[model samples]
Target: MSDSAPTEHVLLTPGPTPLHPRAVAALLRPMLGHMDPEVFAINDEIQADLRTMYGTAPDTFTALLSGTGSLGMEAGFANLVESGDEVLVCVNGSFGARMAEMAERYGARVRVVTAPHGQAVRVEDVAAQLSGVQMVAVVHGETSTGVLNPVPEIAQLLRGTDTLLTVDAVTTAGMQPFDMQGWGVDYAYTGAQKCLSAPPGVAPVAISERALARFAARRTPTPLWYCDFEGLRDYWSRRAYHHTVPVNLHFAFHAALRAALDEGMTVRQRRVREMGAAIQTALAPLGFSPYVQREAERLPTVLALRLPEGFDDAGIRAALRRREISVTGGLGPTAGLIWRLGLMGEAARPAPYRALMTALEDLLGERGVAARFDEALAGVPV
Candidate 1:
């Protein structure tokens, strides 16, 4: 017997995944005044939860910037970098390359240590680029290519250096293990819409003591008015007048954080990891292969697939969409060569995965590839 059709479209894209019911409910609530005591209380709770999620000390500075993850990235660079300062960027995917570009635009003498698409950047490569660099930036999870860079190793390599290490954990924040303090990451950023299961709008950023020190010691002010770290921090605290805080998004973000904590970080990470392993095992028999060669380097939430020869990338994705399933195509170099499937937040659960896989089986069968729906699903331990 066929599974019942889902009541809503399944979101299989790398981000903006299906929201948790609590998050949706929170989003629907009426907005509060930016200065309301209740709003302040919710924001405080969100900040505390964010610190826990980032694995940082209680005293560490954390704030929700009023933009997407890219704003977080810009805030990290703009607040820390000065003109003529040397900056090194490790680029393995679109997001990594974006860091390099943003650094350059900030007037830093940017140097990029790059790897081929669908692969993680090596610690050795990043180390080689570190000399005289005032800051080093890398993306912890490269959603575009489904590769998780060796962030802890890179952090270890940069230890004791004056050069700060910044990371973009937009896709890895809740799904994978991210210990900013333990890993010695000075600055790390994540989006609300990814593993947080909230809609896009806020970027929850954590700043280390070293990062705060660097910000304090900066010779010049951060150019951007909206995302300036100091300004955001003050606004979140007693100041309360940086910008009109997105009150509804804050509610959604708070609800998502509560849901994440309720699930427990350890369990959530394991769920994503197990689902990812199941996907790999299930697809292997159907002639699909992972874009990232090493299992260790693959991102659990965003799975990049190398289609079998003669399979049309656009055609298959379009077919999936028609069936109310959504997946994304590759970006930049990997474009037209691979497909990206996201198992994130609410969508990371068994029901969504089963819906996606069963639909995929039918699509592959239509394309003349005999995919065993039951056998493939049996591989999923959910």
Candidate 2:
């Protein structure tokens, strides 16, 4: 081995979050063959756990794709749309735009209903543009701008129509209370690295019965074989042989999901909410406010904080990195204007937030700004 040491840091970015000790330990455990009976048992457990977390009916199909969260997005569209199908995508941030692009690539006649970067798409806006739409796509939590779209209202608007609802719940899934069945979301996909605190690679996707019906009725087979829903279902059901699954990452993901379930969804949701509010409170003294305009629409898992004027965004991030703290910069239209701070899973507790605040305090103090870290933290409830 080289004489170099590992550079350790407190991870506070959106995805590929700090892993739970249990999950880390699981990752280090011996690997299992994908076709082994024991591995299939583990897959069964994971699907059950995912179904529970997704808040979908027992009949709803939940599968783990051996790719990032975007893989699910691609599969969701590929199974639902045929050539020249009308798809209405609500774009408020980068991910929504990406979904629109993915759908268009699948031969969808995509109509974009857009909102400003920091705001969310209005249900009325989606309603106004739903003319002969085959499917409607939206992001539940737009991590790019920290905006939580109104999913329930939009689902209500799509009630009587044949249009299916597909949601990108990558940042919202394990971080907050998401009800796939209650909200009538036809398809929802999330990553393990975000709120699950597991290693990246496997994405858990939930599909509703309605979506499965649509997939069954599709005239043409999905050209993408790797992510074909029918093939995946057969593999998961043990009827057909699919590609070799990543056993190690699945181990970590299974442990992470168990941890979430053990903590209980409601309690975990409250912790993230309290922590997010704490971060906003902690940063207020430093003139770092939430970038999203509406307080009600702000995501509790990820905080997109608008940078103070005259503050060097890259410089501050670099300074934090030197101190072994990892935070992310803004994406898409919000770049150079905001900082995306994620308080998720194992990193969502008070200690991490306190450390982040203290570091910010020191960084600002060097610039002749007095950030009252103690006072700001006092507002955070224990």
Report lDDT (CA) for all predictions: 0.85, 0.86
**Quick one: best TM-score, which candidate?**
2
303-344 per-residue lDDT for model 1 (tens digits): 998987887889888988898888888888788888888877
Candidate 2 residue 236 C-alpha distance from true site, Å: 0.6
Q: Candidate 2: where is the Cα deviation over 4 Å? A: 1-7, 366-382
**What's the TM-score of every candidate structure?**
0.94, 0.94
lDDT of 2 by residue, 1-382 (tens): 8889976678888877889888999999887788888878888999999989999998788989999899988989988899999999999989999999999999999999999988989988998999899999999999898899998899998887788999999998986878898888999999889899999898899989899999999899988889898889888985367898898999999999999999888888887877676677666756788888788888888888998888898998899999998888989667789988887788887766667777876887733222443454456543
Q: For candidate 1, what is the lDDT?
A: 0.85
TM-score, candidate 2, is 0.94
lDDT of 2 at 129: 92
Tell how far residue 345 is off in model 1, in angstroms: 0.9
